[model samples]
Target: MLRYAATRILFLALGLLVASALIFATLRILPGDVAQMIAGTEGTPAQVERIRSDLGLDRPVAAQYLEWIGGVLTGDLGTSMLTRASVAGELAAKAQVTIPLGALSLVIALAFALPLGVVSAVRHRTRTGTAIGVVSQLLAAVPVVWAGLMFVVLFAVLLGWLPAQGFPRAGWQDPVGAIRALILPAVTIGIVEGAML
Candidate 1:
């Protein structure tokens, strides 16, 4: 079991390396100069060249890839080209919302799926069981984005029970508002996930 686990870990690392390389290669081949974009239309040629030099875009492809991949492995996600902000910091900020939303979604999915799943199993071929099965199938078939939009229309627009978008500016400091904001989105994700469960 220990050996098997070690082998699996090795494969996971290898897979990640390959995937990262492919992604880097794809981005590198895409049209448009990153420095040019950052400098904008009015930027002089010398200014653009300086921007490229500052970003090390003047380096060989291999050297750039190695530097990027090294930074990633070291938890240094580097700076955003446009904003020049730390990518890691941005990701951490986003995680504040994403993590709670995911946890709430899981709770909702289990709360919904467990009881109904048991009921459907217990009733087997009965009319109620069949109906539940059909409903579950339909719910599962709905795209998650579409479900979110419909939920926004019903719960946020028509009924005005929840905010359609944006988290509380005060974050968890405003607990009630934060949870309220998440409800529609969580329900949209949870219900779809529940159907699959």
Candidate 2:
């Protein structure tokens, strides 16, 4: 199990690196100036030039990429152009919400998919298995955003049972309150897996 985990981790890291390289290349190849994006259209020529130079946008793309990657290695993602704050800091703040949502989402997906997959495999020739497989395929076909919206309409708006969007912390003073807030979102994601299976 430990060896399998190490292999998975290695592959996951390589996947992430490849994805990041693709994203970086896409950003570089896209038709737009990063300097112009950072300094708005209304800025004076002198100001724009200064900003461009400051951001190293004046440098060759390869050089700029190396510098950016170097900053990332040193734990500095640079500043947000709009916020004028550290990008890493903003990410850290936002991650609190996003990370839990991601973790909860993964747990729910696995919990739903694993059992359904096992049942479907075991009951391969049974009518119940065929039905489950069809439903799973249909669920997989539906977009997550659409499923989330439907869930909000049904439980949050129509039934008034759960909160719609913002997530409450998992360890909120009242565990029940946190559960109430998360259950609907969890169900929405879980149902997608269940349907897909």
Candidate 3:
């Protein structure tokens, strides 16, 4: 089990590395001046050039990648290119909402999925298995937006059981309201994702 866990951790790291490289490559290869985009309309050519130099966009792709990897390792995401705000702080704030929602969604998904998957695999030749498979496929094909909309309509508009949107702006202060607002959307995402599993 230790070996298995280690293997999974290694694979996860490898996947993240590959994904980061792809993102960096895509940003570089995409048409248009990234420095200019970052500088926006207020910047002169000189300002843009300075931005590029500061960002090390002037560096070779491999060098830039290494710098990025180093920063990531050190938890230094740097500042926002546009606003010059702390990127790490912004991400940390956002994670409060995203992390809880994700956790709830994962729980909801697994609640449905584990049993459905077990039953489906166990009874593959049976009519019940066919029905479950068909339902899973149908749900998987349903776009997330459509699912979210349908959920909002049902629970928020019709039955009035949950909030449709406007999650508590109080941030973590109103934990109850925050969790309540997220339930419907999380469930929607959960069902859709669980269908794939």
> What TM-score would each prediction reach against the true structure?
0.95, 0.75, 0.76
Candidate 2 stretches greater than 4 Å from native: 1-22, 168-181
Clashing pairs in 3: none
43, model 1: CA deviation in Å? 1.1
Error (Å) of candidate 2 at residue 3 is 14
lDDT for 33 (candidate 3) = 86
lDDT of 2 by residue, 1-197 (tens): 99999999999989987887788778778997767766788887788889888876777877877777788889889886556799988888777556766677778888888888889899998997998788889899998889999989999999998887555555456666766777777778777865664
Cα displacement (Å) at residue 69, model 3: 1.7
Estimate, for each residue in 1-197, the C-alpha lDDT of model 1 and write its tens digit: 99999999999999999998899888879999999998899999999999999998898888999999999989899999878999999999999999999999999999999999999999999998999899999999999999999999999999999998779899999999999999988999999999999
| Rank by TM-score (best first) | 1, 3, 2
TM-score of the candidate numbered 1?
0.95
lDDT of 1: 0.93
RMSD of each: 1.2, 4.1, 3.5
